[model samples]
Target: MKTRFWLSHLRRVSPMIGLAMMVLAACAAPGREAPTTPPTPNPTLTVSGGGALQPSPVPPTAAFPAATPTLPPPPGGFGSPACENPYLPVRLGATWDYQLIHETTDTFTRSVIEVTADGFVDQDEFAAGAVRQGRWQCQDGNLIYLTPGPVAGSVFAGEMQTDVTLESNEGFYHPADLRPGQTWHQKTVFRGQSTLEGEIVVETRTEVNYACRAEDFETITVPAGTFDALRVTCEVHFTTSVAEGMTFEIEEQSTQWLARGVGMVKSVGQTEGAPPYTIELLSYRLP
Candidate 1:
C-alpha cells in the first residue's frame, strides 16, 4: 500500500479537493460530516523546564518482552545512543540507496537517504529531486518522530504548494526492541492551506492514525545483498476535513523487511484504490 496516501489524490480528486488531498495524502473515498469535538491531548508530549517539547518516557509493556535477546550494536554502531532498534540504524554519515518501482506505471525512481545528527534526509533524485526530512528524538529508549506536522517523503509531495501547521503529534517511530507480534502507534493532527498552480484551492484539517506490528523473520534478497530480516507491517488511516464541507477517509497498508544492521531492505505498500508498489535496497554505505 502507499505509505503516504496522498500520491493517489491527483488522479481521483476534484480540482478543488485535489490539492487538499495531496497535502495530507487523504486521497481516498469521501466520508461523513466532519466531527465537531476537539481532539484529546497527546500523552507523549510534555513541557520541560525550559519550555521545550519533550517526549514522555514510555513505560515498558510487560506483555511483550523481546522474544530474543537484543542484539548488541556494532562498535560505533549506526544507531548508537539515540535509536535502539537493530533493524534501523540512525547515525551521522550513514546512507542508504533504494529503488521504488510502481508496478502499474512500470517506472522506477531512485531514493537516497543520509543520516544526520538529528534524524535523516530522503531525496528522490529521479523524481524531480523531491526531498523529505525527518527528526528523531528518543524517549525512554523509544525513537520518536519529533517533528509535529505532515510527514515528509510522501510520493505525492512536490505536486502542490502546501503550508501546514501541526496542532499536535504523539507516538514512537520505533521501539527500543522488536519482538514478533510487538506493536506501536502514532497520532498527529495538522491544519494547512493547499495551493495549486499558484492559486489557493482549499483549507484542510487532517488527522493521522498509524500503527505497526512485528510479524516474522525471513531471508530476503535485494540489489544490495541477502540477509535475515524482520518483517513488520503497518496500517495507516487518514481523516481529513476540507473547508468546502467535505471529509475524506483513507487507509493504507505497508510491509517492511529490516536487516539486523543494514536497516530496511525491502518494502511493499498499497493504498486504497491504488496499485501495489515495491521498494528495495539498491546499495548502502556506513561510517
Candidate 2:
C-alpha cells in the first residue's frame, strides 16, 4: 500500500454533446470548426486570507493522542515533550507494538510489528510476514543495527531501525515544505476516539503500487465524544508517495478531515498524473 498522490487529467469527461454543439456553432459562425486543440483545465483555487491552509496548525512533527489499545508511547519517569519521532520517546526498557498501514491505489495493507527495546543489545522484532523474529541494537540516535534472528541457528543481518532515519520526533509531512521561522498559530480543536483509527505513517518506498489519498478542508467542527484526546472534531491529513529511486513531487494541497474527536481522518495524496488513492487504518500499537 503506497500512500502517494497520483494526479491525472481527464482525457475525456464523458459526453461530447456540449463540445459538439460548440464545434457546430463555430462552423456556422465563421466557417471554422474551432481550432482543433483540446480544452485546457482551469482549476479553481482558493487561497487563505490569514495565509492559513488546511491541516491547520501543523508542526514539523505533529503529535496526536493515538490509541494505546496496544500502541503506547513511552512509560512513566521517561515522560517528556513529544519528540520528532514518537518511537524514541518510549521507555528504553519497554516492549511495544507498532502497526503500520501502507496504501496504494487498489489495495490497503496492515502490518503489526512488536518491538522490545531492552537497552539495545537484545532488541527484538516480531512481524506478521517475517519468517523469523528480527533483532536490532540501538546504537545511539543514528544507527540501528541487526544482530540476531528470531529463529534459532540463523545468521545476523544489519539495517536501520526502521528503514528510514525517522527520528522519533519527525513529522510525517516533509519538514522542508513548511514555512521556516514563521510564527504560526496552533491549537487542538477536538478530541475523541477516531472511528477511523489505525496506521498513520510508515517509512517504506516502492513503485508500481496502488495509492489512495484525501482531497480537501480548512477548519473542522468537532462534535462531543468520549475520547481521551485533548482535541475534538480534529482534522487528519495524510500523504503517500513511492520514492523507489525516482523523484516524485507534489505541491501542498489542503482538504477536510472529518472525525468526531479527530474530526476528519482523511488519507489523500497526489503524484504527477496518477490517480489518488485512500487507505484507511484499522488498528495500531505504539511504543
Candidate 3:
C-alpha cells in the first residue's frame, strides 16, 4: 500500500520485532517514490519565473499563489535573540513542502530523499524530459538505490539536491563541509521552467555527527515539534594526492558550520587506524 506508506517505515527492521537491521532509516530521494514516469512538458529542473521550461501544456492559466500562513513565533527562540526561521522569506515563488537527504557510503545504498518545491523567479530553466505542467517542482517520489539516470545509465543520474542557481534558487546560506563535529553540509540544486532536455540532481547532506557533536544547539525532533538548529556556511576548494615524499600531505578539506538539527554525513575519523568514512544519516527534515 504505497510501499507500506514509508516515512522510512520508522526505519525498518520489524520482523515482528525479531530484530535484524542494525541501522537503516535512510529514506530520502523524495522518500523513494520513483517509477510511474509520464508527465513531460517544462521540467528541466523547475522554476517558473522567466528563464524558460514551464512552456507547453502548462497553461491552465498557471495559478499558484496562496501559501502565506506562518505564525509560530512567540517562543523566545523565533524572531530575535539569535533565532528566527519560520521558513522565512522563502515565499518568493510559491511551491512548498521540500525535502531532501543524501547519505553517501558510495553506490546509492539509500539516502536520496525528495518532496519538491518551486517558483522564486529571476530565472528558471530545466530542459529535461517527462514530467511537466506548471511544474515548479512535482517529483512524485524519487526514491533511491543510486543509478537513476546518467553515468552510463542514459543520462538521468539519480540524486537530487535542488537549488542550482541561475537566479533565485531555493533559500540561502552557502558554505558547507566538515564532518567530525561542528558539522555542516548543504547541497541544494534547482532549475526547471520546461520544453524538456534534462538535468536533475537532488542530494542533501547536513551533518552534525556523533552524540550530536557536543552541541551548539541542535534539536530537531519533529512530528511537528521541537526545532532548534544551526549550521549554514561553506567554502573549501581542494586537490589532494601527494604521496611522493610525504612529509605530511595528509589530505583534508575544512570550512564547516553545521550545527542545526544535523543529518546525512555519518563519518570522518581518519587517523588513528583510519577506517571511518561513515557518511550515513538516512532521514532529515525541518524545512
Find the candidate with the highest TM-score and give its number: 1
- Candidates sorted by lDDT, descending order? 1, 2, 3
lDDT of 3 at 50: 47
TM-score of 1: 0.71
Q: Which stretches of model 1 miss by more than 4 angstroms? A: 1-52, 55-67, 103-124, 146-159, 196-199
Off by over 4 Å in 3: 1-87, 92-117, 122-215, 218-229, 236-287
Local error of candidate 3 at 48, Å? 11
- For model 2, residues 1-287, the per-residue Cα lDDT tens digits are 00111112212110111122222233334443222222232222223574311232233332223322242442333222221222232233433232222221122222223333321222323243222222222212221222110111111211211121111111122111111121111111110010101311112221111111222223332222222221112122222222111122222222323322121233343322334333232332333
Model 3 residue 116 CA deviation in Å: 14
lDDT by residue for model 3 over 1-287, one digit each (tens)? 00111111121111111011110112113555322232232222343574332212321111122442232332222112111222222222322121212121232222112222422111111112212111122111111111011111011222222221221112122111212223322222222111112332111111111111212334544322344543322232111111121111112222112233232223232211123232223333332
Clashing pairs in 1: 1-269, 1-270, 1-271, 2-270, 2-271, 6-25
lDDT of 1 by residue, 127-218 (tens): 33433334455554476653332222234334565555455566766777777778888776666565556555556767777788888889
* TM-score against native, each model: 0.71, 0.23, 0.17
